[model samples]
Target chain A: MAEITLDQIIQPENMVYTRSRIMTDTVLHYCPGCGHGTVHRLLAEVIEELDLQSETIGITPVGCSVLMYNYMDIDMQEAAHGRAPALATAIKRLMSEKFVFTYQGDGDLAAIGTAETIHACNRGENITILFINNGIYGMTGGQMAPTTLPDMKASTCPYGRDVQMMGNPLKITDIVATLPGSYYVTRQSVHTPGNVRKAKKAIRKAVEYQKRNQGTCFVEIVSNCNSGWKMTPVDANQWLEENMLPFYPLGDLKVPEE
Target chain B: MGELRLMKGNEAVAEAAIRAGADGYFGYPITPQSEVMEYLMAEKPHERTGMVVLQAESELAAINMVYGGAACGKKVMTSSSSPGISLMQEGISYIAGAELPCLLVNVVRGGPGLGTIQPAQSDYFQSVKGGGHGDYRLITLAPASVQEMSDFVRLGFELAFKYRNPAMILSDGAIGQMMEKVELFDPVPRSKEILPWATTGKTPDRERNIITSLDLDPKRQEDFNLKLQKKYREIEEKEVRFEKIQCDDAEYLFVAYGTSSRVVQKAVQLARSRGIRVGLFRPITLWPFPSKEIFAMTEQVKGILSVEMSAGQMVEDIRLAVKGKIKVDYYGRMGGIIPTPDEVVEMLEKKIIGG
Candidate 1:
């Protein structure tokens, strides 16, 4: 073959993909192999593709992604634990022209912020909620989350989650889908390349629905917390597929009828 | 001149918020202050002035909504009574720490856990001395009449945005439920100018604006605290507002604010008729505490009588202001009872003059 140079190999036509401009140069604070980084990338890509980089407002929950405002180049507000939905509601209502969304975790959205989440969905606030459920409080040293599976080992539940004592694992996504105010409710994962593509598409749809002002759109990403789960990134993905996917099935639970 | 209308204090706050060009009002229905949202909903300020008024699920949600709206650099507010305000303290602290400007109105009611629905000044300590956590203070304005209730809404928002701090109108059920003639101001148009510092949107002209109270780094957090303290000192120096009546020649001073000030005003007149040289000092800005004026009065008065509907809460501030130069006596009714003007004067005589 003729001597090919580096510049010729980096031609625009040969370029496959690049990081979205909506994502700032600030490096993410998430742990190695954490799913939060992937979700953040998907959200940033969606915002860029929709050309909402300037008109998008994001509310970040008090969890591992609390510093998401630093990584995302968008107008952002940091909400108290579990209050992101309420904050997103007000932002969307006051500035109806802007695209508003909340990035939250299971501990934030399902545990302490349950009332706020339910009420916001019930009111049909025109906002998108991106929920990452890893079945444990990742930032707070892996305590038992509301979505923590039965027999799952957590720092608080050292003997594994006892169904009788700790009660059953909660499926907040399904509960929220039953609410009439929720126009679109879906559950997806980013464990595999195929699944990541699907989750990205779901995020784009959620944002599109938000722009149309068609009530609340909730996307629950069944992610994995490798460090919290005490597993290698690959093992964590396998564990999530085995334990979490069975409980939180991978598909749209509710969608507005065409 | 704007129109003059007879309205309740709560109704006046709602109307004044509309005229002040508030972008949104998020509130929950609490006793005494429920009329604030009721009036806003009835008038549909959303249709008239494009004000987004929503009744939140609870006071907690309402305050967070105010935080969200304020983060967008819009004029937002909420009104609640004592119990409701207690639920809002966490949100208030976060708002203060985030340094977002927003208005809050507390229509005071008896409390220590749903104590009563009647008016009480027991929350004086809670309002001015930082009801929430952290080293923070709210620019508290104690409005004594329906007119002041209307006027303070405009003033509260003005001061809130000016200092980028939360401003509170500390009224009670007495003022909130009572009605009087209020000269309404003409509606001020909402500013269309973009807020460069607000989290409106991350436009190309500026870096992204992030509204947050969290600073994990201890050094940065300490810096933020020092900055807030500096702002508070500036406010205390420039915003200490109070009214003095017959103070230059008075021998005794009655220190009060809000409804107690109204009662003390009557007592001042009654004491003067009885040949007692008594005057009233009404603090308009409670957080700034009007310490300078109260301290100056020590030069002219023999003693100061702190009258309130609470169990001598504001008396602490009066004593601090006096600096032991003169005796500051507290006279008041506990629970929700309102002392009569004669009773206040009698207590002053028994507690200070006779002593």
Candidate 2:
């Protein structure tokens, strides 16, 4: 019990973990073990690692993470539901030097904001789009989303989504990948430490391409909404691995020339 | 003195936007007001003043683009006709709620749905009362002449940023498509002043800026609304703009705005020739509605006629303004029809004078 003082132990070389300064002290409203907190942390870490803290602007969507601005210590704009890409287009064009990104959820991006997402991508706007696909509308109490898997259960579709009646789940990332304006497009997840590292690298590289003004760089994070999914946090991750991964597989859908 | 040129109202507005040092214009092509983006594209203002003019995919995207640009405290704007404006309501509400400064121009066309492309004042209620959700108001300016169409571009931005609210030039297709001589100001350079609340990027020196209308708490949202209403009252007090012609000696008054006001001005002359002492009250600012000024005219005139291109949207405001102190009557032509000055005078006689 020799007093090992705090200052002596918290040396730079010994520091293995610390919250990114890019993230504000505000507690994330995300449910415990919800992927949003992890994704938000990754985004803040990416921005911090890239040293774009002062030159970055984040556009948040209208889902569970609409309040993402409260946690990220960066200039931000909260867009109308699904219109984050359109907003990002304008912000990036007017302030081309600023690193701009839009973080959206499935309903906001793949459904109501589909046109904005497609057109912004098609125009080759130099902005990054971070999409969170949770298979259900998490904020509105687990209503069905465009990405809700067929036969999946939701509050609005409690009987489980019937493909014929509810329509097939949209593969917006795949559709976006085909667009020439998409210089880099990828699908990722943050359920595991290994996956988290991969997702962060995707975000960093996407921002890099945006800095070059290459075109639209999109990163779709296949995440879990345990609260909306009506499952425990652990079960949600296991379910995401079994059901979500097969449909929305995690991989680079599009990549610039080697 | 500025450069004088004969230009369409829409074109004049476009050129004036460049001269006003607007940072960007995002628009979609639509009848009557398509010339705005067309002119911007053809002129290549990007080369002229480094202005960013983009043809957005749709009115929805266009207004959102304005939202994004305006949140950064940039001088940005968008133009559309009635149907297109309807599509922008969602974004407009968000902009109003965020209290971001921006300009909008509605070159109105007749509409209940996909109505005619011809000029109409039917959007009067939409612009003033608001076509969007919530208790919000846009500082609306109605330009009777192409000069005002051009001039309002600058004035609209000034008022918008002054109160950090949206300003709209509520013109009709007639003024948007019609041509008239306009005196254009010299091109000013883009503003270099920092907007402390803008989301341009967070500097290490200060806290991050967030632009949003979301206040999950009812009390906080209510307080924000009360603050908004207070600003609106200030605007109503200081920004109500109008012009009175021959009102000092008038026994009757005509209250109108935009294209209808232009025709009503002529009707005033026609009514005067017929031994009727009538004056024209033209509201330049529509949302502040010129209510008090029009109400005060009740003491001078025996009656008021609210002429418009719709069945009678603005007449309701006049009725409220005059408060039954005098007869408040209405005459209008619907579906792209413009009433003749002679016909307008006759109706005034039958409606306000005798009724």
Candidate 3:
């Protein structure tokens, strides 16, 4: 085999990217094998494929992905913890021309902002919501999230998340789907390449529906947090698939039949 | 010119807000001010002009919703009574900290805590003194009549965007619920020239913008506060608004605003009839305090008698303007009780004339 040169790898002509990177090329500080990188890539791919980078506005919630704006090339509004839905509601209402989406964690969506989320969805706002369900608060160092699995270990749940004491993991997508105005609701994972591709499709569809002015599209991406889970990235993915999926089943809960 | 219609003060505000190109209105229903929301709901400005109108769960949610729309660079607003406006202070402070331009209307009511729903001016201090926490101030306008109530909607939006700060229309329950004939300007499509700097989301040509009030560094917060104070000072110099009645040569001038100003108007007429040489100093802009005009009048007048439906609120500002050069006395009736023009004239005659 011929020896490879740095010039060949860095050449502009050889670039295989047909889609523009709406997400910045900054080196993400996520731990190795962290599912955030995969999730971010999928979202960026959807934005690129849909060509929605220019018209899109992302409302970032207070969580690990709070600074997701730094990486997303589109305009971003940082919202108070759990208030992403409220922010998105106002933004979409006022600037109806722009495509608005909210990126929230389980804790932000189900805990403090439950009322805001429920009402926004019920109102059938024309906006997309990307919810990352990791089952723990990664930003504040692994506290128990509203979506934390029963008997799962977290800093706040040192004795493991006991359902009897802490209540069951909230299934927000299903609950949201029950609202008449919620046109599309789905849960997907990104552990493997096939799953990652499916998640990108779901996210792209959600954005497309929002552009069409469909009411309240929600896409939940089940992800892994290695640091929060106290596991390696590879191990975290496996633990999530085996333990998390059973409790939080993935698939389309609501969709407009075409 | 739009078609002229007879309307209440609250109804006019709601109609004018839609005409002024406000994109969103988030409000809660309260006594004496419920007509504002009721008018919006009936007219359905959302369907006609693409405006969004929501009766929020509470005053707190309504204001926060305004905060959200303003962050997106949209012209948004909310109206509430004293108790409700008090609930909105935190969000108001956040809006100010973010330097967002939006309209807030307070239909004044007697209150320390839900004191009474009847018309009162007790919210004077709260509106002009920066009701929320933090070192910031809102541009406040006091409309004494139904006409001014309608007029301030456009003026509040203009000033809010000009100063990149929240602007308030402080009316009382009587004005808010009072009905009168109003002539409003024709509907104007939202002018892009007004707010070119509003956050329109991520465009390929510009960097991402973040609107927030969180400054962890104390020094940075101090610097921000100083900048805000400087802006307020400039507003005092340029944007102060007031009305003068018979102050060219007068011994006693009654200083008041909002609902109290209307009573003072009648009292001035009564004093003039009695040959007491009483004039009225009504501040249209309460935050800037109309100090310049009050000072100008003080050069000729003997003293100022502040009349309000509160214990004593505008009196403090009158004192600051007069600066002990002229005696300043206050007359007020609290907790939903309004002092009539006769009562104010009597007080002036007793305190400044003989008593």
Candidate 4:
């Protein structure tokens, strides 16, 4: 090893990646190894790459990412619980030239906000919806969410999610894909590097569809909640691959034909 | 000069909104106020002034849409009846907490559940005393006529933006449904300047504007609340509006607002004809409540009568204003019943004058 030193590896010509300028210097409030940080990074990168840093506006939901505006260096609005889609609809309609999107969690998008979610997509609102389905309400102390897997234990479902009693785990993305207003619908995770790349691509495509004024584009990130699941980050990734992937499946559920 | 046209109160609200340079109207149909959206849709304000009119899926969605539009610093409004306004309380609270400016028109009907569709003033407490969660108050304007209905639309937006708080036109079905001569004003051109505080977009020249109501830290939330309260106090000191008719040397005062004020005006004339020496104190801004003016009247009047179309909701505010200095009595009709002027006179005579 002839001293191929740190300076050479860190040179601009050799630099492979850097933090997106679309993200502010504020430290993320999410816990260590949380998937929200990865998702936020991917969104920042996609927004920066699309050159939407100035014209893009984001609506954040009432969850852990409620303070997402602090970290994202873009104009943002915080919607009431489950009302992000409704807000996004108004924003897009009022300023059709602007790029608007909503970042929502499972409990926010699938449960309390189901009516707004389906109707926004059904009406073909020209906006993007970034849904994070972590199978539990991560912010409000790991309660059972609408997407909580059957037999998956949550704080509210300590005895495990009984399918018969709690009803089947809702696949809201699938339900939303069937709506005619939705032009593109896909589900991906950010657990692995490959998955992160795919999720970033999906985000870019959704933004592109929004720019074209196609219709509502919904991208669901089936992520993991390590603390909520009471597992280490690595164990949670393994559990997600074995469990969430089978239920949520990684692929495009709907896409418009060219 | 704009046209002086015969229009219903709700229709005037829509037209005035168009002429006032409102940028958007997102509303759901609710009885007694559905004409607001119906008239907007029919008039196509979008074609004329570039105003966006949308019939939302529900009152909940409509209010949130108003929140979004307001966050962008666009003048937006929504109209609903009692039940629908109740559904919008959560969004209204959020708007208040975020300190976004928008107009809300509540053509109140009887309530306490799926109440009647007919006009009533039962939503007084809900509108003025913070209907939604948290300590917040709407700068509530009570429009007593079709002209006031039109006038308040512009005034509501002005006061809303001035304080960066929500303002409401608290009318009733009686005003919303009744036709009257309204002198519409010339269309004010929409502002071309971007609001510095609004979340339009983040340019490289400045930091991003975030419209949010959440402050996870208790101390920060308390500070926000204190700031809101201080703003409310300033509004109370500066924005108390009322019409004091014949109150200089009056023996009895009838405190009423909206349609009840119109009817009470007739009753005051009837009482004067009967040599009862009665005056009318009509509060134009209900949230500012005209408490100082009401307190001043207490020193001059022998008694106060709070007349409304609801079951004594505003009477509490009147009593608080009087502070037990004078005998404050309430006379109201419940379940969407509109009392006649003669009936109001009779109640005044029996409750305040005779007693």
Q: Could you tell me every candidate's TM-score relative to the true structure?
A: 0.98, 0.98, 0.88, 0.98
Leading candidate by DockQ? 2
Q: What DockQ does candidate 2 have relative to the true complex?
A: 0.89
Q: What is the fnat of candidate 1?
A: 0.81
Candidate 3 CAPRI level: acceptable
Task: Let me know the TM-score candidate 3 reaches against the reference structure.
Answer: 0.88
Better of 1 and 3 by TM-score: 1
lDDT of 4 by residue, B1-355 (tens): 6699999999999999999999999999989888999999999988998899998899999999999999999999999999999999999999999999999999999988998998899999999999999999999999999999999999999999999999999999999999999999999987766999988888989989999999889999999999999999999999989998887779999999999999899999998999989999999999998888899988789999999998898889999989999999999898999888999889888988889
Chain A TM-score values for every predicted structure, listed in order? 0.97, 0.96, 0.92, 0.98
Q: Name the candidate, 1 or 3, with the larger lDDT value.
A: 1
Q: Which of candidates 2 and 3 reaches a greater DockQ?
A: 2
Residue by residue across A51-126, what tens digits does model 3's lDDT show? Answer: 7776777877777777777787877777766777777878888778888888888888888778778888888989
Q: For model 4, what is the error of residue B322's alpha carbon versus the real structure, in angstroms, after optimal superposition?
A: 1.7
Model 1's CAPRI class? Answer: high
The DockQ-based order of candidates, best leading, equals 2, 4, 1, 3
Q: How would you encode candidate 4's per-residue C-alpha lDDT over A1-258 as one tens digit per residue?
A: 697989778888987788898888999988788889898999999888888988888999998899999999999999999999999999999999999999999999999999999999999999999999999999999999999999999999999999999988999999999999999999999999999999999999999899788789999999999989999999999999999999999999999899
So what's the TM-score on candidate 1? 0.98
Q: What interface RMSD does candidate 4 have?
A: 0.6
Instruction: Write the residue-wise lDDT of candidate 2 on A41-140 in tens digits.
Output: 8888888888998899889999999999999999999999999998999999898999999999999999999999999999899999999999999988
C-alpha local distance difference test of each model = 0.93, 0.94, 0.85, 0.93
Candidate 1 chain A: 10-residue stretch with minimal lDDT = A207-216
Candidate 3 colliding pairs: A75-B202, A151-A161
The alpha-carbon deviation from the true structure for residue B345 of candidate 1, after best TM-score superposition, in angstroms, is 1.2
Candidate 3 residue-wise lDDT, B1-355, digit = tens: 6578888999999999989998999998998798888999999997878888987767767887898888877889999999899988978988898788999999988888878889898887788898999888899999988888889999999999888899999999989888888889888886554244455765656676767666657999889889889988999889988888777777878888877887888888888888889888888898888877787887788877889888888899888987888888899998888889999999987776664
